[model samples]
Target: MTESSPTVWGVGTTRTLRAHWALAEAGVAYETKPIQSRSGETQTDGYAALNPKQKIPFLEHGDVKISESYAIVDYVFEVFGGDRVYRPATSAERAASNEWCSTILMELDAHTLYVMRRHGDLKDLYGAAPAAIDAAKEYFTKLADAMVMKLPAGPTCLLSEKISVADILLMSCLDWAVLYQVPVPEAYGDYRKRMSERPAYQQAFDFNFEVLGVTHKDLPR
Candidate 1:
């Protein structure tokens, strides 16, 4: 690895998983700086200096500091993914990948999955809202139904024959759904199963868990 290898800071959450998985899929050598959110590590003045927003999954590559999980995935792909299997091969494929990522983040992750987490597992922290949880469940069920139709006959990528950034995004979101007990359509359930079996995915998972000293069971459920 060169001096250009990036450093990622975050625990074993879904957001951080995306960054780790993307870097692994891109075949990029990177380092981890695991920030313990529960212990207020991200709120420190030092970490705050790197990210004013003080979010987890912050990334440092060369002189660039990137926040947000999807942006980190994009950065890894753009900077290091030349001829990599995880990138889109054409303009149309790229557009499709972005579209899938956007829809999944906005509709499924932000609207449905996080809402469930806020109400269910993190209820003590965020204050549970029964009505909001119900509404989110309804919305997610519809979204999952639509995703089943949208997903290709996959044991493959979301948009093409090869994996792309979109697959990383969607797989992380689906993992969140399962962790948080969201009902997933059969198609996407199979999709998640297949993607999770990838060597890159396992590598990322192992790194996050080993560094953070947590397992899947340790996550909020």
Candidate 2:
């Protein structure tokens, strides 16, 4: 790989998938480091030197270094905007897009799905809380249903007809929710099916998840 080619670190998680997916959508050539979370790899001296926070989905393109998955996606589109993917063009558009991204990341991802992951799947490490998990699941359903209702009746994405980072972010969270067996709106199901068929998303899914011996079809829809 050329030194200037983008490098993405981490795999096997929805967050990491977002980074790879954005690069694929942009049709950018890049390299992969394939680190896993909680696997002691992120704690290594080399990785820690690259990112003190030790988060996956980190991107390094020349002098640009971004740790968060959302920021990485945003950076890619800024450098390589395309017809295949949508990045906000105006100040008002960017603000609205940011609103959708922030809500999805917080409401559907960190605030809901990860709550179940923490207290349910990783209970041995994070401790179990049946009540919290149940509450979180209910919260996810309510918010998702409400969000679906707000969508302009018939478009494949969250922000607009063209797929954007907001759509990718929301799609990743929705996929995570489905894997966790959280109830989601029927509109969400339709949107997920359509978005999953995107060639870029398909490529990213394989690159981001094939290392783990699973595919989207292997998981529940």
Candidate 3:
């Protein structure tokens, strides 16, 4: 890819979808490397040179290279979104946005859903831990119970009318949790439906999931 081109590495995971979705929302066109985790793609010499950590959902734009889906989404919003996307304009607004992002990542993703992912679907590689998976599922439901209250009636978003980086992170996690049968909050169903109906989300979903026979329906297992 050229230096000015924005390129995203990896596909077939919620994390990868986050990057793709963010780019779409920001109205930035990018190239996809179409790499999958643990398929000997990230282990290649070329990918090793790009990211020593060998993780998917890495970003390359101009001279900047970014790892982590959350960071990439934040960067895309800051750099490319202009007024097309809503970005926190004040310190307090930023704090509020950060609060949503942090809680979603820690509580919904790493702390619960990811634990279930490692022990459940990926059991062959990570080794099944039924107790851990059960605990994770229970933890997810517990978090959802409290989190549902934070959501507003009708259509919902962390930020009222405008979608923010936090919403993208949340949509990705909610979908992942549902795939794992983690009992995601029912209140979020309509919220997710509305967000998924966005043209940008549809674009990203098609690119990330509709490659050949692979689809989001076949994911997480």
Task: Tell me each candidate's RMSD, in Å, in order.
Answer: 2.8, 1.6, 2.6
Best by lDDT: 2
All candidates: TM-score:
0.89, 0.93, 0.91
Question: What tens-digit string does per-residue lDDT give for candidate 2 at 1-221?
Answer: 88878999999999998998888888888999999987899999999999999879799989888999989988887787567667677998889888788889888898999899999978999999999999999999998887766565674576677778888898898888877888878876667878888899888988789878878667565
lDDT of 3 by residue, 1-221 (tens): 45576999998788888999988888876788999887899998999999998998999997899989999999998898777777888998888788878888998899898888788778998999999988988988888777777676656566767778988998888878867777876777778778877888877877887654555444332
Question: Each candidate: what lDDT?
Answer: 0.80, 0.85, 0.82
Q: Looking at model 3, how many pairs of residues clash?
A: 0
lDDT of 3: 0.82
- lDDT, candidate 2, equals 0.85
Instruction: Specify the poorest-scoring 10-residue window by lDDT in model 2.
Output: 149-158
- Enumerate clash totals for all models, in the order shown: 0, 0, 0
Better of 1 and 3 by lDDT: 3
Residues 1-221, candidate 1: write the lDDT tens digits: 57988999997688888898888888888888888555689889999889999878899988998999989988888888776655665898777777788888999889998898888878999998999999998898798787676688646777766677888888887777777677777767567667766888888877776765755444332
